[model samples]
Target: MPTSTSTSTSTSTSTALLRLRRQLLSTAYGNMDFRYQLLASLADRALAELDRHSSPEAEELADSHLRPEYIGITEGRALSEAGSLGIDTSGWEERRERIRSYTRGADAVTPDGTPADSAQRLWASLFDNYPSVAAALADLLTGLPPSWRMDLFQTNDLTQVPAEPRQQGDNGPETAPYSSTDWEDCAACMEANDLCRFHSGFLAGEQHLRGLLATLATDSIALEQLQDRNHEIGQRQARESAEKSPERETSQ
Candidate 1:
């Protein structure tokens, strides 16, 4: 026989869990969008670099920048870039079409039987491809409130049992547990998480591009110096041969 108080507590927990699930879903989707924009900005910058100083090495770097293993992450940005560059994009189009068909099909779970939620899929795709980004997201998770973390674990079936309800006191309804200050702390943590993820992702992309550009610039400079040195040596050899030709004529 469950008391009304216990029943009410269970109901409250259920409601909180539902709210938290929605929040998680929303956050995951938002993060996916944020990552896509970051990648797209990087792709655009690479393309601009190619347009300004087109070289085989630069083009290859741009290709690598645009071509991530997870096609959905870029959403045809690579295909569009390939077409603009007059490269064959038929293979990419075909792959995208196949994915579209599969998404439209009746499969509700992944090959491993995990539920195929779009937000979760995109989140996993990004994190799996970008370890730094994964670290940033993990930091965000670490910043969550302990109670919220526990709720998340329970929601995901990671916990074997529900958390025990706080003991009621002589006072009424336990004063609602979470204070306004706690909520402000959660909000602050979320803000910090966003900033951390953005900065980390930006720095990663910038470093990759800068390193590629530097290497290409160095190679170009080295080639030019070699060509100049070879030209100077050829001229010296020609002048020496001309001087010896006059001496040979006089001897004859």
Candidate 2:
């Protein structure tokens, strides 16, 4: 009897979870911002699970690479990986140096000198000059859940999906290209341009999605404020009614 009850409970829980996932996916279907929320949540939970798998020694090794002394270690590692893959690492050292020159102290100064709130300069440079790297980084980090495998903006034909407007930078190389082909090509063009809507334009598209999410958040805040205002008005009316009730009762 207990085994049967346990099986029934498990089946019920699975059914409920499936229903909830379908509901969320349906809401996220045409809504880009909600899709981002669902994706981000899934990514965060996955990362947390992965983090739990890390041994202390593995974390220590990873942390060691993050130290100031290991400044060029990441580039060296990338070069090693490229060499293993038989990819040409020709000008990578020079490119890395140029990137370093631009990134040095970039985080120290904001135009407004607001150190407390600063932009990630190193990330900005990479995403600006080398969008492919940004795409790889995003894939490594999040690599969307299976549920989000469907094309984000598509009609009856997936190929007919419209690319967002391209916003250029001063440097042509820095400008993310609009990929007409696929998400991989599109992501390669996202070099810090927030106007691109392609999944390939990872960081920029995320930023664009985030802006929309922020607007939604503000709307939610406005709704909460309105509810609070209504609550206050209700309370005041109740108090006034209570205060007048005794006088009316005495008069009667």
Candidate 3:
């Protein structure tokens, strides 16, 4: 495990790591919760638009955000661990070197003299430092504190989108930075028609992935057909460009 000289700071690091340790069993759940929180933030904007009559789509938007599911576990145990790098009573950028030495991966290395595997292992260790990750693992065959605090991510981008309700209009959905689902239908349709999926989903069946598929299949613009049309459009553009060229530009 990583070390913190500041015994006072140890609690904070331990608390943070316990959070990530929990996630070992709840990666899916964490991602799902993260998505909804994002949606709720967007809804707040729509809700504020009372004076402008509301959009039918916006209500659907609000409804979608309210729906909730749980984040599942990340699975497996971490062979190593990390704690918060205790900063001196004073904080400064150059002190990062001191902190690096304490991370779970600080001394990890391969016989070939590379830290690649150990480095990745370190990432899994760091994520465990979050309450969300810890909560996900609470039910696993792992140990967790009885009085654990939930760790949540806060982002200005979440509710901080610029199109405050008053600012929204046909500037299109682009005005709002958008939570994942805010423009889900539009984005899904775009994805479907684009065929980025069919490549086969690795983590495809989970809620968010399922949700994306549901949207693309049910409401997304016709992707397969669109693909064909896009090909045609490209051909047309090429033909047009060719016809307008000043020289035969060679049949090369």
- Whole-model lDDT values for every prediction: 0.47, 0.52, 0.37
**Global lDDT of model 1:** 0.47
Model 2, stretches more than 4 Å misplaced? 1-51, 71-76, 85-177, 180-184, 187-192, 195-252
Best by TM-score: 2
lDDT by residue for model 1 over 1-252, one digit each (tens)?
A: 334433443345434322333444455455533444555456445544543453344435434544456334464676677779999876776766654443333234232332334334434434434567768888997898867745756554544555345322111111111223342222212222222233444656977989877776789876677679999999999999999999999999
Error of 3 at 87 (Å): 22
lDDT per residue for candidate 2 within 103-162, as digits (tens), equals 444525433433222235435656766778878887865876544435444344444655
RMSD (Å) of each candidate, 1 decimal: 27.3, 24.4, 27.0
Provide TM-scores for the models: 0.19, 0.25, 0.20
Residues 19-125 of candidate 3: C-alpha lDDT, one tens digit per residue:
33233224433433333445544534444352134334433443443445323322121111111344232433344443343333423432232234433433343
Q: Which residue pairs in model 1 clash with each other?
A: none
Query: Which wins on lDDT, candidate 1 or candidate 3?
Result: 1
Q: Model 2 compared with the native: what TM-score?
A: 0.25
Best by lDDT: 2
Model 3: weakest 10-residue lDDT segment is: 168-177
